[model samples]
Target: MSMLSVLTSFAKRDFALAYRQRAELMQPLMFFVMVITLFPLAIGPSPEILQRVSGAVVWVAAILSLLLGMERMFRDDFMDGTLEQYTLSTTPLYAIVLVKVAVHWVVHIVPLLVLSPLLALFLNMSLPMYVALIATLLLGTPVISLIGAIGVALTVGLQRSGVLVALLLIPLFIPLLIFATSAIDSASLQLPYGFQLGIMAALALFTLAAAPAAIAYSLRVSQN
Candidate 1:
């Protein structure tokens, strides 16, 4: 089969499994909403206070949502023999990983980006910063998803590895957090925002180039 055909096949299987496990899948989205709601409560009813903190709140909520959503992505396939077959197939494992990462980002991260504005309102985010927030998400979120795929690949079979995965990823995510927050902050300050946006774009590009290869190497090492 052609490379495109193999990726198409993998994409179908991935989405099919996600559909069958809809409730489990929705947990992350639900968690994001719930967490955002809790922020206002914990920080008191002052709108100013909430507004001051909303950018970080939305970003944290997003990270948590991705964490909730990633565990089953690689774990299920690895346990059920599908991943083994893929590794043994003629199709490049890195290509297969790339496809799965794309599909995972679609199902998991896209919703977070879409719903961010709504979440931002609850945290009292200012209206002016909305475009910067959305732009940051659009330019930066694929890196989050790709980094997540690496975490999933590394910890797929381990018992109680979620903490480990978080530990592994949080440092890597710091640059993302910095630039993402900076973009929104720039908009709030009425300073230039595109520079931060450009940084995020660069990171996303790097992740796209590197993640698939990293996942492929990890799978090979694991299989050995």
Candidate 2:
């Protein structure tokens, strides 16, 4: 089979597996909603306050939710020995890593994106802010997935590596969180946020170019 066929097969297999494990897949989305909902109760339902912090609150929830699901990105395949086969296969490991991460980002992030507008209303976000939030997430979430995949790949062989993966990744994610929130914050103020969005786009492009190879290497090292 050709490389394209191999990668497409990998994508289909992962998507089917994700469908079979729907409950496990929904955990992150539930966590994301819970986090956003709790903020109002904790902070006493002030529109100004909620609007001011909405970006940070949503971005933080998103990062945490993504991390909650990151551990399983490779563990299932690792345990089933499928990951080992991929590493040993003639099809390139980086391509497999890219497909896996792309599917994961879709499976986890799309639900969150769908729910974001409602959550934005819950947080008293203006239309401009909501638009910025979507823009930032579109550009930023993949960077989170790509970078988070590296941490997950490195720790997948270990028992109970969830905390370790978060510890390793949270610091890396801070820059993304800052840029995303800053973009939303600027929108709230009726200011242009292209600078912040530009930085996020650059980060996404850099990670997209660099992360697959790094994750492929990490998986090989972890499985050794």
Candidate 3:
């Protein structure tokens, strides 16, 4: 089969599986909304305070939510021997890994993106900051998925890997969190945030280029 055909086949399978297990799929998004919702109650309802810390709160919650779902990225495939078949297939493992991560990101993050407007309003984020928040999330969340895939690949063989995945990946995510929140903060001040957004874009591009191969290698090692 052509590479495009193979990738499309894999994507469809994943989406179908995600649809069947949608309750599990929605966990991350629900956690994201709950975390963002609790922030106002904990810190009081002052618009100034919410707006001031909104970027940090939202980005942090996003990272944690993504991590909550990261463990299962490769677990099912590994358990069912699909990963071993991929390793032995003529099609490259990296291509399969890329498709899996892309599907996971789409299945999980799209809901968060859709719900972001209401969450932003709840936090009293100004229009400029809200736009910047979306921009940063668009650029940064893929990087989170791509990099998190490597950690998940490494630990897919472990019975309890959720905490391990978080431990391994959260430090790497800190830089992204900083750049994203900084962009939002700049927008709040009515200043340009092109630089922070640029850095996030660069990180996204770099991970998109590099992470698939790293994840493929980790999967191969884990399957051995």
Candidate 4:
């Protein structure tokens, strides 16, 4: 098969497997919603306060939700020998990693995006705030998946690498979190957030270009 065919096949297989494990897949979405729900309860139903902090709340929930699913990204493949097969295949590992991360990002982030409107309503966000939130998420969530893939690949062989992955990844995520929240905050005040959005898009592009190679290297080293 051609490289595009191989990439598509791998992505479809991963999506099928993810569907079969739908319960596991829903955990992140559940956690994301519950966190957003709890914030109002904990902080009281003040529109002013909720709107003020909603961007940070959403961004944090997204990061944690993405983290919750990161472990499964490579664990099943590693255990079932699929990861090693990818390593040995004539197809470039970079393409394989790209497909895997893309599928993983779609599976995990789409639900969060679907739920964001409800979250915005609950938080009493302004229209601008909502748009900015969605924009940041669109550009940022994939970065989470790409960067998280590297951490997951690094620790795929370890029995309990969740904590290590979090440790390695959360720091990397701080800059994204800051940028996302800052954009939303600026939007809440009716200021231009295009600068922050551009920075986030640049970060996402850089990750898109660099992370596949890093993930492929990590997977190979872990398997050896």
Q: Pick the candidate with the highest lDDT.
A: 2
User: For each predicted model, how many residue pairs clash, with residues at least 3 apart or on different chains?
Assistant: 0, 0, 0, 0
lDDT of 2 by residue, 1-224 (tens): 78899899999999999999999999999999999999998998889999999999999999999999999999999999999899889999999999999999999999999999899999999999999999999999999999999999999999999999999999999999989999999999999999999999999999999999999999999998
Q: What tens digits encode model 3's per-residue C-alpha lDDT throughout 25-108?
A: 888889999999999999999999999999999999999999999898999989998888889988899999999999999998
TM-score of each: 0.94, 0.99, 0.99, 0.99
Give the clashing pairs for model 1.
none
- Cα lDDT of model 4 by residue, 1-224, tens digit: 67788788898999999999999999989999999999999999889999999999999999998999899999999999988899999999988999989999889988888889998998899999999999999999999999999999999999999999999999999999999999999999999999999999999999999999999999999999
Clashing residue pairs for model 3? none
Assess candidate 4 and give its TM-score to the true structure.
Answer: 0.99
- lDDT per residue for candidate 1 within 158-195, as digits (tens), equals 88778888889878888988888888887777889878
> lDDT value for candidate 1?
0.82
| After superposition, candidate 3 runs with Cα above 4 Å error | none
Error of 3 at 213 (Å): 0.4
